[model samples]
Target chain A: MMKSKHIPEEQLVDYLLGNIGEWDAKQIKAHLYHCKKCQYLLSDWQFLLSQDHKKFQPSQSMKDRIQHSINQMEGKSFKRRTVIGKPGLLFATIACVFLIFYSVHSYYQDINTRNYEIAENDEIPPETIQSAPHTQQIKVTPVSEFNQINGYVWVNRNRNEMLLEVDGLEELINQDYQLWIIYMDNSIDHEILPTQNGMTRMLFRDIDVDEFKKLKASVEPRGGSIEQTGPDTFIVEFQ
Target chain B: MSNDQENIQLLKDIAAGSRQAFDIFYEKYISFVYQIAFSIVHNHAEAEDICHDVFLEVYQKARQYSEEKGSIKAWLAVKTKSRSLDRLRKNKPLLIHRLENLSGSKKMEPGADLQFLHSLEKHLIVEALKAIPIEQREAIIRSYYNGETHNEIAMTMKKPLGSVKSLIRYGLNNLRKQKALMQWVGIDRGEKK
Candidate 1:
């Protein structure tokens, strides 16, 4: 069952590939404006599209020449035979092949240099796990199915702050474990924290302890799931 | 009746000596092949040349378009990519050979078949996609294959647009890095004592 409002993957693919008709394209465009899941699907599609539909364009004269060639072929009764006596075409192609290869090669080299410079200058923010716990903090323990669980949920009543820590688990790649505070009104997931050397800690701000009934942590897709709910890895009762 | 059938009929018209249909076809797919060629070749002039060459093939071989294999746009894309890569390997000078040998004996031509080149390029694409980080890979695939926009990617990834752009740039850079490695491997094997 399609529980979520996200457009199906099949329809998304067809829409992207321009296989769908005008009415469908309009409908999909409207859906896409509101659908983040379908939009994220584009990031994955960008490579093939970019690779397949490069940013390059043809010049006007080249277009005319191609059009001229088509005209000539049509004049020749559409024989499907190759054109001959156009040595200029061959030379033009040769010149293009050489110039483009040089430019693209050098252009990418320049980009790599720039990105390297950016990397060198870019500041690495302190890991969320390593952020210091605030002064006003309250402590609770998370219950995990795994027997080796060890972490404290420190909630600061004054600032509605919480610091979460867990040890003895491998830090996964392209996966995130997010903490959600389920209140009487609604549940909210806090920012993700990077784990290292089998340990993780994150400071959650704006926590309303009065309405907080339960806390949850779930391992989800890299950017976190579009849905607020997913498979829970750890749970804690605030009571 | 359908867009595909309409395209197939347009191709049939082009095959049967209709310059008007040829013009229509050219307008329909020029951007598809041109951008692909330019992106691969990275020169406007050269991309135009590839565009010319691509359409030239279509002009002569309109009859060969098959709905069974793929859409016309995809078919043109593969052709553009293979040609672009062939052009990318400028040191090889295969273009001259292809041009010189054009309309010559199929049995005697020294150049690799277009189909083989297409397969090779596809393989390279798959390998490059594999080598990139999953997050970056997913982003690229979504943008290109799924036809999602950068803003869409940003929203979906819960990332800023700048981050999304960076992911694509770095992902492509990684693909280039992997391309270099693959080329080195090819050279390594070629140079074995």
Candidate 2:
């Protein structure tokens, strides 16, 4: 199964609402950097959300204070531009450099703090479908009559994350269930499905689902196989 | 000139250190900035302080504004919202976390819960929000206003993560459809006239 190439509407909404995790936010930002369609959608959401608030007027004193600050800034900048010679210019340049460095440092610090907060307070459940519109849900059906194992794969291509859940997968003697992710370019990545009570639930991060073409499960040697050298119990192909 | 064009011109003038332009621009958008801050902080004095800080930043950073990025109103909204959230975070470190308790188990249909509804304005955006279910609206507002994440929202709403995501997704989709319908109706009315 393949999803729409565009970033899903729900994802744009998530990004706009700032509900997205750091990794997913980074992925969406990277995509929006090159994608004009998504940029427009994001802008639309921004406009709509911006207007959702009711109007409240500030006191005249607050307005006066802001105006006073603005006037002082304008005066200082004008004086600096007009009166600055070589020494003043050099000093101004140094101040500018320091400001830029401090801004950059503060930005990194903010990001780190936010990441820490998210990690500490917000923990996503493994079964949750992140960005459902971008997720490709594949039903891994039994390939043969003897295979009673049931499995499903959820690949969120945008976030490069996947969730693989299997049920009714009875244990095999002297064998392990190996999961294979077949790539679009004919490359393959395999992982041993560690099961607990006839159920396997695995969440993989940083695995690009766009590269995935097929998912297959096979019974392999006790340690798992280097390749797909076992009988295919379940298989799913992406188009 | 169009409102956006006029605002852009004022921004350009403010960037060039024109106090008159700055005043005009401030007069035009102060209510919007103040309102957004007030909504977030729910305290008039703090919101006023946030507004003062935001306008000062706008004055200093006007040169950095670009119409190619977005409209001036949207840019100011972003500035106001960012500053207001910063104020909220600074004043009460646990206020956002405490907001989770406010998300009660209220099962109300669209238009049934007017508690979250602000003063009804003429904007279709507000109307569109009014048309959405209460839970979804709360999720979106908490996420957007209170800066709560999906997981936080799920916990706050006493729902699963998937359900919270669905609520936001469906809520946004419904708003988008309502906006599109409003635009279509506006065009039809224009043609009729």
Candidate 3:
């Protein structure tokens, strides 16, 4: 008699068809990885299932009926934002709406400031500013010589936050973007700071007015604490 | 459109209250679902009703779709099978009881067992079975589709118990061999493969 621990060859067919339980499923998966014979069997079963496909085409009217039922269910459940509702739910909804509006408004204001700064200085040619979108809230002036670098850094004066946006970055495997804060005193090489949770968005907080003036942005790996600033991803001097 | 992706998008649209996409999606999978039900129920009218009910359940539960779990086809198959089984349980209690009582009936014939083997793709399974030797094919169809136990088959065929076991074992092995040969030749190469 074949040991019960040794799965029967016949069971593999049922296993692949999702007829087996957890323990048997695990055994089959483990066995398949090392056993070419079982793999071949699985491959044959898969072939059989594929051939069976054409023979099972569903009719058009039956499809219509199923879909109609789905539509009715969707209609009943979808609820648009309502003005009159429970107090707590209404308050939470309004707060969410307000926060979204505020974030978008603030973002536009920062972009506007960057544009204005670029126009007044004319230090950077107008071409660089043209690439950045225009907004009515704040003006941004691009520093002329700094535009040579591969990335753009814009400071938000109202929020006291500096935004470093990078483009044309070569994709890195197992590598990520990091940022550092350079102190004005020049006493410290640089205070390694975390910028951008995932290399996409960076936000620097509680800027010392003097230190903020001299800060530059750099890209580093994981926590970005390695060296002060090897080669700057972006450099900006606050006006 | 790729069928799976098209089905997924249709389901998504259905969830978003798009009646047209829902209709198209339903039309695509209904026959496939019906055939599965038919295979289990073995009656056209009842299988059609089961198929309709299965799709209705699918439609009502569109929002519950989780792509991470399994493919739309597998999910649909499972739901259809469960619903089909439920229908069978409810509608065929008397038939099942009768079969249980008649389980001990002597004079089992090979051809009678053959009647149980119906494939959604009838032409293909039939063709494949034809390629195998007659004894092996009969043994396989009896044990598999008919769910006949080895002892039952032995008693029915008036053959020695050991001979019946050998027939089933060797028959399955031969079928497996033929399947491997078909795969090697690249015949019926499709998704299941």
Candidate 4:
């Protein structure tokens, strides 16, 4: 159980250097939001960097080359604008608008459906998925017994996909849980969404599973699969 | 003109794809960018090339600039440093020689005054960083200069997620303390009053 209170020294360097990934960055961010000491420390480092900024000085030739490059790019852009023409531009604009509208509408609908499914799930909100306990196998229990949870399974209306994330999962290994988007009509096969490394939640969209009432997590071999040879590790049913 | 106001105007012109404004920006910050690059790369020619490439990237990606996220200076500094580091990593043999030369110089006396004010500033920063642990210094440098995210730092450093967070927290805390101390003992004589 790595308590959030103490961040390793190495990681602090990585975080300040912007070398950490999004998940870790988010975790650090959450920690920073709560930890004033860390926030002040970060601000101080930023100030140091700001002060260091004064030492930088470029040569005159470099300036000339950059100006030359910018000039060339501008010329190309001007040529492109002329080539595009009013009618061509108008058609392109219309096409872009139509595509954007279609994408947004479909995306919105998809998210709405995914959210509805997640909400109907009697299981805990996906956000509440904590860092799993470190073990060979993760026991997916209902949220009722765990500490406070913060998770979300909403659709990204723009992307037309359901984005699900369960933070605070106890770290576990060997046995990984696989997410299955069970569809209605029995015509569409169950879709297995990919899980991010060390992520406890799953998100999928563009799934027309309005009639599907359940989302299941099955224990699979390390790198999860479409096949569900293993038993259901966790089950969340839509109301 | 105030740096911030000039930056805002430059960014606006950049967003509009004005090459002249970009040239102005290049002129203004090229030296600063070069010095940082040279410090990391430790070579004049390569540093110049890196600076050129960084500015070119800025030109190409200017439209993507948004004031809400960060300032142009910060963005340029980050970009230049990352590119220089990447070059440094790729040319490890060269870096080894440079590092050897740097450590061998032994020109820096502990309490000696640096020639340029900028050198003094660098000395102070590096000294402050030294007061903290290496890991913290590494984290600060990577995050600030390399423009990497927290997870990337963890992966690169091969440390657990939690420890990385703490290192950054503690590192920053120590830095703040040093900064406060420095402010308290201002180099200026008037501060004695």
- DockQ of each candidate relative to the true complex: 0.12, 0.12, 0.07, 0.10
Q: Cα miss at A165, model 4 (Å)?
A: 20
Model 4 chain B — which ten-residue stretch has the worst lDDT?
Answer: B109-118
Scanning candidate 3 chain A in windows of ten residues, the lowest lDDT window is A114-123
Model 3 residue A83 CA deviation in Å: 25
Off by over 4 Å in 1: A1-45, A51-56, A71-239, B91-193
**Please, what are the lDDT tens digits per residue for candidate 1 over residues A1-239?**
22345554445545568777798678777877776656665433344364543333465687688877656534432223243546778977667668767865554343212100000000122332234455433333544554455666666565555566677554666466655656655544343434433456655444455666777777765434433444666677766
Candidate 1 falls in which docking quality class?
incorrect
RMSD of each: 28.2, 23.0, 26.3, 19.4
Q: For model 1, how does the per-residue alpha-carbon lDDT over B1-193 read when each residue is reduced to its tens digit?
A: 9887888899989866587898888888887777666544446777787787677767655765656445777667666665565454432233323322332434543332344334434454565688779999989898877999999999999999999999988886776575343432232322323
Span of 10 residues, lowest total lDDT, candidate 2 chain B:
B113-122
The sequence of per-residue lDDT tens digits that candidate 3 reaches over residues A1-239 is 11223333335545666666698688778877777655664654453333333444445565555455444433432323445567779777788778767865554343212110101110122233223454112222223433433544555444444444444333333233434444444322232222221223333333443444444545544223333433454545544
lDDT for residue B123 in candidate 3, whole number 0-100? 35
Of the two candidates 1 and 4, the one with more favorable lDDT, higher being better, is: 1
Question: What are the clash counts of all predictions, listed in order?
Answer: 25, 0, 26, 56
Candidate 2 local lDDT, B59-118, one digit each (tens): 655765655434566567655655554444333322322132222312312222222222
The best candidate in terms of DockQ = 2
Alpha carbon lDDT of residue A199, candidate 2?
Answer: 65
Arranged by lDDT with the best first, the candidates are: 2, 1, 4, 3
